[model samples]
Target: MLDQAWFSKVGFDWHPHRGFETVTLVVEGQLEHHDNAGGHGVLDPGDLQWVTAGSGVIHAELAYRRRPVQTLQLWVNLPRRKKMSQPRYQNLRAASAPLVEGPGSRVRIFAGDINGVHGPAELHHPVTVAHAHYEEGGSFTHEIPGDHNGFLYVVSGSVLVGPDRMPVENGHTAWFPPGEPGLTGIEVHATQATQLVFYSGLPIREPAFAYGPFVMNDRSGVAKAIEDYQSGKFGPIPTTHR
Candidate 1:
């Protein structure tokens, strides 16, 4: 969560990345992104940006305004098979998400299918990502694929998770235990007006060597990525933002 008012004064400069993808969600204010691959976008609240640095790429992110901005950024590893594929980007606007509304709650499916509603972005990995908001006393149930690992993060307020009603407070995260080989229904009951993000993904079950912006399967891969980056193989530094 990038929320401090002082954060507006700081910004990420040009950097290199390889062997992974970045998923960024703007929760408040705005974010501007740019990459050497010619991809650029300005993300407003509820918008998402997905960048796949398949082989390599250089990019930067900066606050779009001089105000408090809250953003969530995730690094999704690419399988070894697709580590050196082609680089790509997806700028998913907020309205592209499919909205699901219940009694006192609503959800925006941003990166995967939910109850037949599909998200706008396509990726190499299988994952379900959603942002949801609930009024006090609101409740909802969703099914998760058993083979995927899942977690619920309370962005604000409080909520009870699962049949056990495990309490998850603001700024905290709750992990769901591994389940059987099928879909499992999970319930959420908001104890107060709350907001949260749900993320579930199929595990890679492979070794990972991470150093700064690079994520590879082994040390040799990381070294090679570093060498290539130093050799100007990750493309030139991106200087502009949209």
Candidate 2:
């Protein structure tokens, strides 16, 4: 889910996980993430912190300022073969990402190519992420690969997608199914401007078992994870939750 936390401080302390990939993108303010696996850092605007909880790990995220925090956290499905692999993390900074600009639009590539530039966020699966900003009455077209499930989230102003002229307003999301077409057109209508974050990924064919920050293949795995954490298998509790 897309989360908008306004000056919110959460102590959802670290825990263990066996399978899945969590991608957290910071859109505004700052956040600090620490874990027992020797990974700790802070995220600023346009930064992406991805943790692949393959085998298991303990982690935490805390707000570090009084200003509101806006970010997107996505849970990606992992294939069965990679479910038990070793844990990994990627911290991508804003300078590492690529940006494309035109007459009335700006595009930031997070995982795929726009025109010819590509983002620096490494991926275990095929995906594309882009943040687009358009001036009033501006328009652009994004080419979607065949058989790829894609969606566009309007973060500000209003945008029209596809020939049906589907109206996507601020805080609304629009999805494009596979095998439909190769390109999706977007038009912004507002006195000021418009913005959207686009995300597309390969569809997984495996079952998903999710329980509050932990995602596994089945209920048994989830139960085992909970037991392991309670037994202190991950690590000792941190002195500060933040």
Candidate 3:
């Protein structure tokens, strides 16, 4: 998560990533993204950038406007089978995103199902991701698949989660354990006006070897990734993005 007043002169320069997908949510201001695979866009509030750096990709992200920008980025790890899959990008604009409302709560689905309604972006792995807002005393309940592990990140305000009514405060996160062989119903209630993001995904259950921006299965894989990147296999940042 990043919340700051970014200036035009300072930003993330060209960087390389591999063996995972990055999901970025712009919540407060505009974010500009660019990559080597001809992917480029300006994301407004409520927008998302999903980039799969399977084999490798070079990219950059910076503030698009002169203002405060608050964004959250999640890295979805790839399984061993997909560690070297081709890179891809998806720009999910806010205008076409799906929304679910109940009482004083509203949820925007980005990559999952909510009450049988699915989100837009397709995934290599099954995952549920959403942003939600609630007024004081608002409540929401949803079922998560049994095999998935999930968490709720409180962006602001306070809320109670699960049947225990666990209190979660601002800048905190509540984790939900994996359930039994069937669906698990999770409930959330706002003690005060609240904003948060929900993320759930099936566990890969594989050993992860991470170094810098690369994640692999073992030390040898990480070495190979570094050698490949240094040998110019990831390719350079696109000229247009410059």
Candidate 4:
């Protein structure tokens, strides 16, 4: 899962930070980071780094020469009220997240609730993010809130979703349709080996626009973000940061 966030395939580079929230989940290995606000440090596996690039922030992920690393980064969107707020960060260790285990499956939840176990993360919207591993022939099913959107990303192996039993493989993502207005949830079955990340969030359905690293609710907002970054509103990364 190294750099699995959005699967950009750009092995973290040195660039001005983006105008959004970045939640990084380290599955293996570690990372040293440098941010424009004079923030620099190393993150170990099972660690989560939540950075709000609010108005703007510049940062980069440095290579950890120790061993290979696996990670997943998810971008969280802020509402109009918070888009221009001060940038901030939240660093959470794995111990803070809850790992629930059953006879044939295990789940580590970072947000929302899973089988009565609550996660450690807090968000602006109601969302759930979890990593699940199921042994062969293991299956799991849960009802999603009717108002939220849900999807699953296969990290390893394969799984069949829905009544049609569609097969989703590694590196592939399957977005589930919104639950029925009166239904509570859906079911997922694993006929073979399987591991996946399931995420569900309340739909915002707001207009979204993006320009490079700048993400805004509208084109005018994007323009403001660009102007602010160029005018030094986001601050500066130390020249020694490489």
Give Cα distance to truth, residue 177, candidate 2, Å. 1.0
lDDT of 4 by residue, 93-130 (tens): 77777887755677788887656678887666677787
Q: Is candidate 2 or candidate 4 better by TM-score?
A: 2
Query: Model 3 reaches what TM-score against the true structure?
Result: 0.93
lDDT of 2 by residue, 1-242 (tens): 45544446653456666688777777778877888866778889778777888877778876755455677777776777777778888897767778777657777787865455677876777777887888987766776565677788877788777776777888889887766545444333333488778877777778888887567878998888788778887677677644
True-structure lDDT of candidate 2: 0.73
Per-candidate TM equals 0.93, 0.86, 0.93, 0.85
lDDT of each: 0.82, 0.73, 0.84, 0.72
Worst 10 residues of 3 by lDDT: 1-10
Q: Hey, what RMSD does candidate 1 come out at? A: 2.2
Better of 2 and 3 by lDDT: 3
Residue pairs in candidate 3 whose N, alpha carbon or C atoms collide under 3 angstroms: none
Q: Sort the predicted structures by lDDT, highest score first.
A: 3, 1, 2, 4
C-alpha RMSD for every candidate: 2.2, 2.7, 2.2, 3.3
Model 3 stretches with alpha carbons more than 4 Å out: 1-9, 238-242
**Cand. 1 Cα-lDDT:** 0.82
